[model samples]
Target: MERGTRSVVRDRDVCRRHGVVGVLVEPRSQARCAVVVLGGAEGGLHEADAVALAQEGFAALALAYFGSPGVPSSLVDIPLEYVFRALDLLSARGYASGSIGLLGGSRGGELALLVGSHDERVGSVVSVVGSGVVTAGIDYAAGRLDRILATSGAAWTVAGRRLPHLPYVVPPELVRSIERDEPVSLRDAFAALPTGDELEAISIPVERVRGGVLMVSAGDDGSWDCVGLSEVAAGRLRAADHPYPWAHVVLEGVGHTIAGPPGGPVAPYGPGPGVTFRYGGDPVLTADARAETWRRTVGFLRYTLPRETADEA
Candidate 1:
């Protein structure tokens, strides 16, 4: 495929969830054929990843679960059935010749594993900063402090005690929601949802999955247990003795959000807490880390997704 004159298209269409309209991007070149799906956090798609995948010669689609018309950002409100239905839309649309690869980060990563496990049509799967196991509750208080220090380099204090270094965010509200049966606040509602463990319990075996998998973990990420999450998922796959191909990586320095150049166009979703500012956090691929991530992603798709020529082989 010619690298120049890249073709890209962005449009909205109704997803399998009846009234939900999602955004889809189709990359140019007939040589490489793979449909890359972007998973959103609360509900909307991460636009940066979508653009990056498309630029690398893969058709990318981003599904909006919430913040789209009548959709709600609360994860607990969205039904599991609807999420699968959106995946079915990809296969039904003949994206990737009826078999496409899945890629998601954070919460979307957990969802990708679940949907890919349940569906046979997925050709490959990649999860960035995703966990396969769940913690009893999310710790957001440290996250709040980490955010303050990451950007401003300020010291943090809790209960009148000054801390030497930035702590992870484990907000009490988050814990309260996790333990509460009926979420009284929106924050509680989000926290009350199932962790990765719940998703894993319902997930199918990776060995049984038709597509390969590429799992990436941000070791420096303080929001979740990145190392443990990747290990658990990878361990399960290794134990299954499955035929599917899978690779796992734990990047040492970077966090969950990936930028292009040093601060040039960081991953979309706004300036998150505890996010190290590189190149001013462009929300695009501005940092070297995000650029490397894009390169790796493109390479992975070329190798794992269906190929037409032996050159990629």
Candidate 2:
């Protein structure tokens, strides 16, 4: 939905009231459900994700965890309580139901699983191109110890302490390729994340989740092995015998950034057609999958967190 659409309401700075930095999007009328939208390592609030659900009649708050004014400098030293605060605030909002849902992509997607599994306040989770285990961010390691010329390191920190994370070091050759403006395959840089027995240590405990789960992934995710990781999460849920309805939607030919553009196709950063933006999937295929993924996400939320009132406009 475009800005100034009569059916919608947008508050560019809802975080001020909540003591967080983010955006709030809602329908003009009362909403049947409430959802918290999250963005990944790229930082800032995910305003578009919130607006997308708002257009579908849910009250969505895109809470900023990092990369915004007054937000954390990096993923380090963040607080899970901030997420809980958002959840509690939504619970108190009369326009929405008592329970809350989470929708996130990439790093946001990884966090969606964490909050959904750990916090009973969350009733459902929608993760796109997210991992089953905690993936590290760039600054997580470099910030602590200097002289480590690594590309990807620990990405998350809570209450000033960093979580145990796996690093993806960019090879020296790839670094040179980047300096020379040559195309270096991202696969060469993405580290081989933990697997099999190692997964037991880092994986999120989905069995503890009190609500339904839905995850989306792509086979050719150049960013990381999301499809493989999603399977790990699905397996965890099954092993735990999670009673809630859950599904891992693996879209073929899509990339790590599976969602559709907020308004239009994202512009290439800077002058040349750079390698950094080399997310897989053709425009048509990704768009079709994006629309369908969101359609099912809304459906999953509706089923899991049905409205206490019957006022869907």
List clash counts for every candidate, in order. Answer: 33, 3
Question: What are the per-residue Cα lDDT tens digits for candidate 2 across 23-123?
Answer: 77889887777889988767887777777788888888988888889887677546667887788667656544325888888778888887777678777
Model 1: residues with Cα > 4 Å off, grouped in runs: 1-6, 14-19, 28-32, 40-42, 96-98, 134-204, 259-286, 308-313
Per-model TM-score, in order, reads 0.65, 0.84
lDDT of 2 at 83: 83
RMSD of every prediction: 11.4, 4.2
Q: Which TM-score value belongs to model 2?
A: 0.84
Q: Residue 298, candidate 2: how far off, in angstroms?
A: 1.9
Best by lDDT: 2
Q: In candidate 2, residue 290 scores what lDDT? A: 69
Q: Which parts of model 2 are misplaced by more than 4 Å? A: 1-4, 12-14, 94-98, 140-153, 158-161, 184-187, 195-197, 260-275, 309-313
